[model samples]
Target: MSENEEGTPERTDVRKEEEDSPRDRTRLSDICADVKISEVMSEETTVVRESESIEDIIELMTRTPYHSFPVLNENDELLGVIGQDNILELLFFERSHRHHHTHLMAIKALSEDASTLMVHHPVTISPDSTLCDAADLMIKHHIDRLYVIREKKLAGVVSRADIIKKIHGLRRQ
Candidate 1:
């Protein structure tokens, strides 16, 4: 039994299974070591269509509070990706190229579609990939999220937040 500040008895018998084993205590790092991408990936992905207007994409970004999204083709196959940085770069390019009023620059960029703005060939991962691999990929590529693909089609999305959530859930601290 464990006691809090009030000195009330608290159950600390979570070690039941491991009680008889040599490793009675659990470490968060050990628990999170075996976690795979499929275990933490978000299946409900919000992707953008290749034909959607850049304005629509931007609105989707602001409205949904999403920083990035995968761009798909007519067949729903993964095409590319568009992130906040990508959109901002395009907008900046428009402003520089046009050298016009802000409103006119926005209107000009709005006419552009996903195909023109998407960052082609985004980094992807497999469902079987370990969390360590995913993290390594993100660090190596300087990305915040990864698209989980199967059979050349998008299956889910895994992000830094997801990894953090999984580790937090271990509760071994």
Candidate 2:
């Protein structure tokens, strides 16, 4: 007898055939169903004002996991972003041994205005835009996140991780 009969009836090497039918491609609506920018966004976003002190900004960075934040003006208008890199640059310049302490102090005094250090005119995306659009914008600009706007106000923020999670979820299906 063959191995199949000798053993407990070795399973047949039969493969189920897929029906000869065309599968419906997923549409944007389907991909976005029940998913909103507000749903996926990190709602508890850290924000700093243009007038915030560098010390305060540094403290915020130390306390939060975010590397960047949306800066707001006194009127709550979007100013730009302040990131960890910006703070690092300032600290490094201030502590450089090549510069005299007096000179470093002078520079620090003039750098008190956070607006001067904040990035101006950061790219932003609307909250209603498709995730694909957001992903494309990030890819084109080589950025990690996009500030989500709604009614010309900061509504939420979308990051690369959010997009990756959505893609991974679809793959599992």
Candidate 3:
């Protein structure tokens, strides 16, 4: 593993394969079904606090390569998720596209904390869930990452890159 441009650890040894190859697809499917989310998840997840200011979130985003962060309350319970897209939209509110853009824009202008900026009810998966289940949820929700929730708390996180690396590992083996 090597650090990427952003200083995030990256698996440089993972080889890319043809996504449409029938044999590879079959093998990937089998592997996904067998592997648990906990096996490939990022155990020490960087998270944001609901009370954190937008400046704090921006600072974190600049220092870390993560595109999103799980927002937690004082009790360490999952509240929601705040992503780069959320910040971007707020920053460029003039080009808003959502039906409730005005409403959101007003809220953003008044609130500087994560609790108001986060997307509630984010898609999540259990630590015991199979990689297959995580993958399915990601595809269904068009998301790049899923927060692993266990006992109503954040357990870890599973990203699309993690699953890809797992598949690559199996292919090489």
Candidate 4:
């Protein structure tokens, strides 16, 4: 459809065929395997303290674009993740939406601090891990993002959007 640098007409049909070939798929997978998590993750991540009150966390949710935040202890160790689902319990006072009333939801509703309210043992990946590893973990856990942990501390964060963007960029090149 267009002329290349050599002043010859480029065969777009053949190029399209090549893109859909198994070799190209293998190349893409190789790129994913080679790319590290630290290269694609956001280092300047927003986090919350475990001791922070529910009011403070609510305020933070209102101010930030993030739907979830990694909860940290005084020593900066990652404790858990506090997401919108955890905060939604506060909206209902006496009644729960589930068919069977859950005692855990009621406890979450009564929780005062981030530590008690947060979801424990959040899915995490190491910064040293590959982008493919991150993708696999996210798919297995059905999560949109993963907290990058190092030495039990929050190192960074990688999101599904980040991986998609990286793949798109590579394709363009």
Arranged by lDDT with the best first, the candidates are: 4, 3, 1, 2
- Write down the TM-score of every candidate: 0.71, 0.68, 0.80, 0.81
Q: Would you list the clashing residue pairs of candidate 2?
A: none
lDDT of each: 0.79, 0.72, 0.85, 0.85
**Clashes per candidate (backbone, < 3 Å):** 0, 0, 0, 0
Q: Write the per-residue lDDT of candidate 1 for residues 1-173, one digit (tens) a residue.
A: 77878998764555543354334224544555588889989999899998999879888988887889999988778999988986886677645654554674455455588876787878889988888788778878787889999888898999999987886566534
Error of 2 at 146 (Å): 0.4
Highest TM-score: give the candidate number: 4
Q: Candidate order by TM-score, highest to lowest?
A: 4, 3, 1, 2
Tens digit of per-residue lDDT, candidate 4, span 61-144: 999999899999988788999988768866564666574257777777788999999999888889889999998888887988
Residue 69 in model 1: lDDT: 92
Candidate 3, residues 22-97, lDDT tens digits: the string is: 3566767888899999998988999999999999999999999889999999887899999998888887776666
Better of 1 and 4 by lDDT: 4
TM-score of 4: 0.81
**Inter-residue clash pairs, candidate 1:** none
Q: Is candidate 1 or candidate 2 better by TM-score?
A: 1
User: What's the distance in Å from true for residue 171, model 2?
Assistant: 4.0
- Candidate 2 stretches with Cα past 4 Å from truth are 1-38, 94-109
